[model samples]
Target: MTDENTTVPARPRGGLLRYVVAATLARTADGGAVVAIVLLVTASGDPGWLAGALGACITAPHLLGPFVARSLDTTRDGRRVIALASVVHGATLAAAVLLYPSTHAIVPAALLIASGLLGPLLTGGISSRLPAIAGPSRTSQRRAQGWDVATYGVGGTVGPTIVAAVSAWASPHTSALVLTLGTFIAAGFVMLLPYSPPASDARDVPRPARTLVVMFSSGPLRRTLYLTMIVAFSVAALPIAAVASTDQLGTDDAAAGVLTAAYGLGNLAGSIGVMARPLEGNADQLMTRLATLVATTLLAVALAPSFSLATAAYAAAGIANGYFFAATLAARNEYAPSEIRGQVFVWTGALKITAGSTGTALTGAIVGTAVHLPLVLAIALTTAAALTSASERRFVTRQVRAADHVQPGTVRRD
Candidate 1:
């Protein structure tokens, strides 16, 4: 099964750059939206509850991502859906802008939530298009994934700064509108990219619902899902810790942002590294090691006595994070039936969002208490690593079986 790279796309590096650029622009709005919402809520002086509501809005769409991704079968249909989503997303943002005058918070929040709820379909549409654009080669597909991850890394690194700058000059509502406009522009750019649907004869013909359910049934995928969730939770620790350390230890907001940026920079570098080489070994082994590295580094970050040490720890954590993201995606790609790839990916997105929200909640609850922040994070990460290792072992066994059944001699011929 691992050797079955037949259906994967093959495209030149140049083609990937076009998609990458589009991806960068596409994600910019999403990232910028995060900052805009955060600032808006912070400025409203209801940071805790409003921020939590915003987080719910953003993560809620992911819950249905797996379900919606089942529709990514037809290239034409997928493209139309993406374009329509872009328009709707823009309209919702405009609503937010107008409703800002109400000052009741509920109306603007409804608009924000609506905008977020529609994002999965748009994102799923894009992922489906990637395979088409990349062609039928494993290398090309990997590169495409690399490009997407790189764009994500870049956007994450700079998104907050952009929001801060905009808010400083304008208002949060204006910034939100600006970000929405950018989303529409990116959607147009992506629409211009060439794509050909899987040939009708070659396309997967399974019942869409059944195929989607199968994604969660796979042992490797389940393990991956669990690990991804933990990684999401772990994500909250760094930024929260950085801010607290600075607030309590006299580190400036600028310093905290620098540390965060360093982590993102590391993620950018790691994406390139994964793209440069194919993942050929045991998927479980790779993920376990990376998860352990991330946890260990986070522990170190928690224990650091100075800003510089914390910065380095965060950067190292980012590198581990980058590797984990790439490796997990590659593994998911390798194992998932091409027919259901979008469903799997969108579900992964949901898992990531929920895990992150959980992590943030935990961080907020424990940071000011009797528990030492480093110890708490270290324990969470270490537990995650152990859990990941166990799940990966089970996952590898199932993958080996799945691989065996796919080989010519293994399954009984009809």
Candidate 2:
């Protein structure tokens, strides 16, 4: 729901800046851990299926993000919780990287799941406290929210690029392990933040079912959720696509990361550009057009005549996706019911992670020595997303007006 004029507390701005840095690093560390796991397993002759499985394990916790964030909000020692969560996130990731080979699936999957559950603390958990950090007025809070949104966009795309690029030149296992240290660095910053969790009331935490009902009742919001999920699912597979594409082209395996890094680069560029110059009107319409573009580019990548052409097509799809991500963010805020404004961000962010996990798993199952199937499937999903863009006019506004209205928890922009 839109908080067109939401105000902020007169807290100092200093912590907000530090929180942003910590959140960015935490995101980077998570991405690095996932890629590191995938690379480690695939290099050791395990089927790529485990790679997707691990990705999903990390993402599943997002489904429970609101509850977890709420729980954190009630505690007086919220700063410690955030710090401990960060450490746990890194520790679990590092354990999986080091022990996945010997323990196989179950233990490592559990570790990743634990890490994923802590994800909200480093991201949405902190973002919710923004009113206190940004200070004095709603406009300042909104500006802060904008930065959080951009960080989410960049973190999602860049983490893979950095890790994959390093793997291209260094030991995948060692690089993965080294990258996990960033989480500890993030923990240090989080520990220092002045996180005074607001006095909590258990009665205020919206039931998960109620939150889900609210989302489903709004047609535009529902479609946006589906769009976010499908887009995420499709993008998650690109890493594996890199491996499959290289195999099909019989290129040096070391260069496979170039394809992955290219997509990340394009996505980062597109998201940043859009944020700098906000789009003019009709966010849903923009989403439809950009989603179509994304599907078309994915199709192009699938049928490209050579490895180089495929890489270019892949990057094009990423750019279109970046634009779509921005549009989706706009659509969510515009259409989400005012009653549930608080919960929208974190819940949807969870859905994105969950969708990504599904995408990664599906790709692992079907991916072989070619990129055709995964890219084609991505095209199909994005096409569905395009078709799903439009909804009955005023439907969301009507739903909000009629909603039984619960003031939910803080917004998690990611």
Candidate 3:
């Protein structure tokens, strides 16, 4: 007879490094997709609106995230599915780059839009697999989540940096080519993780409708999801704000890249700090504090008197945002039901991204009418997020414990 108390590890611990590398590569490539589209549109001398339209096209497909992740959650060989999605995403992106220079915008635009079908898989789906990849322990899972945040910091910083380097040296098309290669390489790394699959009771699987209900039914999870969306909407204004900030300094708008890079680096540094010391205590309470910090820093950034000060303030915002993000991820892990956790991740991730994309689209259309509109809106939205997170109920530790009981262990042994 099997020992009732026996503990089985999900995979070799060493696979964590491979998982992080794969996630970093996929995210870096995905992050560069917009930059590549913008550059390619400029080179092709297409209507400027085409670039933004294509960007929306690619982003719109995040709506499919839940369905994709639902399939992933129930499947045995999820790694294979993830790898295939990355490959397809990369290939289609490369094809679009080759097809669209100046003419035939329709086909290339369609391809870019199609590339988005698997976009969330490359992002949130990869994240959902972390618990199993890290193995069957809460301690290991939390540590893995910290490293997961590190991937975000690295990817966000490196993606655009790579695009800039290749655009400066070779061509916009070459930069896209480099991205394609990177995704393929990322897929290879993904396949190298330990092969055994985690098991779930099929009879216990929740229906799709039930999954949605489950997500919103939990207090901590519901609030955490809303916080993520609110903050993402705030973050979407960074590019426009960066450009405006440079204008304030009497510097060329290109100098805005410095502000952007500063934020990414600061985010990276904050994530590394989390890796050094994994988060403890209440995630919801921590989120409230971090969201407030994010707001404070964004306000400072907008009001900064000089480019140097603006960069520093923006970097500070990045650090706060990073910590807030880690808290968000942790909350999802902590509160979501084990069987539907992947779908919960995908749904929340998709919606948060949709909020960002919507903010960006609106900023270009309705918001550009005013000079300081983007920065002003960014600061306001971030402040709103802080206020939303601050609650009379935050100190209720009993709710967190209740959630832990309702939601079984996320990590499982095969």
Candidate 4:
């Protein structure tokens, strides 16, 4: 007879492939739009300030991700909602493309902002469905999350490359149109995916304020968010540092692109590795270790004597960064309750975007300083985050052990 505790492995679901492809296309469109917008604005003879404003407009709606994702949580058919949003977002991009050249700044900017408002459907909505797609097993969920991270990395890398290649050969307008087409294709795939809304549990539901409180109350969740924010800030400093490093080393601007590509390649490799060899030990501990590795790599980048060494260091940092992302996602899956998982995912995305944008802005202000200063600052911030994670781990361990000793039916006050 089979042991009562044994679990049979779940058969892989085919819908998962469709979901991954759809999500990847959405992300690629989103990433390509960034590069396309810059190129289009520049080609239209707009000032740098206008391009920056448009970029901010595109990203600003992501700050409302939690609120926007609430509709997804409440809807009876999440796939339909996601598909509809994707279509609308794509249409907005198409409109922007048509109006980019001769139209006033306000028109395209408004269109871009409309698309941004639908961003949560593409990101958090899709991610929240991973558990359902991969079955109820923890191992399957972890593997699905790893694949999600890898897909996102691939989309980000491919999107910018497509824009660069198209803009060099054709025009930015063509690139924008291509990206808009991608979104439409993604919408079609989303509609084809087999998704059924999860059964509602009244006991699982919590008020938004209560949800926020609970998320922050968990040591693991709180520490994960903090660590993600710190890492995001550091990552934002990379581009500026890349440009500065090329100049300091007497290399052409192409060197900056090469360094960025190296980092992206490393991220892709690390994400794939996570899928192949699952992480062991507590999720929180694994995340802390990865964050520490990122810090060490950043420090090496700061002190590198040559551009070649700096590129390798950045690549190493990227590997750690990718693994940290996978670990953080796993931690959230393990720690967050089912009802509020969507909110948590969207909230984390918003926070990381805000932090990274702020870091980029600040780094821009100090770009004239020493070339390595931003990397040094990133090292300090990441190191602090690692230490914070360690302290939180100890506190959580103590709390768990104390709870274990409490007798049944006795009031155990903290």
What is the clash tally of candidate 1?
A: 8
Instruction: Candidate 4: give the clashing pairs.
Output: none
> Which runs of model 4 end up more than 4 angstroms from their true locations?
1-12, 199-210, 403-414
Q: What TM-score would you give candidate 1 relative to the actual structure?
A: 0.82
Poorly placed runs, candidate 1 (over 4 Å): 1-14, 41-55, 74-76, 103-106, 122-125, 198-212, 246-254, 276-284, 370-414
* Candidate 2 lowest-lDDT run of ten: 1-10
Q: Give the poorly placed runs of model 2, Cα more than 4 Å off.
A: 1-16, 36-67, 72-81, 91-112, 123-180, 191-202, 242-255, 282-286, 306-309, 331-343, 367-371, 393-414
Any residue pairs clashing in model 2, and if so which?
A: 1-336, 1-337
Worst 10 residues of 4 by lDDT: 1-10
Model 2 TM = 0.71
Write down the lDDT of every candidate, Cα atoms only: 0.68, 0.71, 0.79, 0.80
Superposed Cα deviation of residue 254, candidate 3 (Å): 3.6
> What are the runs in model 3 whose C-alpha is more than 4 Å off?
1-11, 101-103, 135-139, 196-199, 202-210, 247-252, 364-376, 390-414
Q: Each prediction's TM-score against the native?
A: 0.82, 0.71, 0.86, 0.91
User: How far in Å is the alpha carbon of 82 misplaced in model 4?
Assistant: 1.7
The top-ranked prediction according to TM-score is: 4
TM-score of 4: 0.91
Winning candidate number (lDDT): 4
Cα RMSD of all models vs. native, in order, equals 4.9, 7.9, 6.5, 3.4
Q: What is the Cα-based lDDT of residue 292 in candidate 3?
A: 75
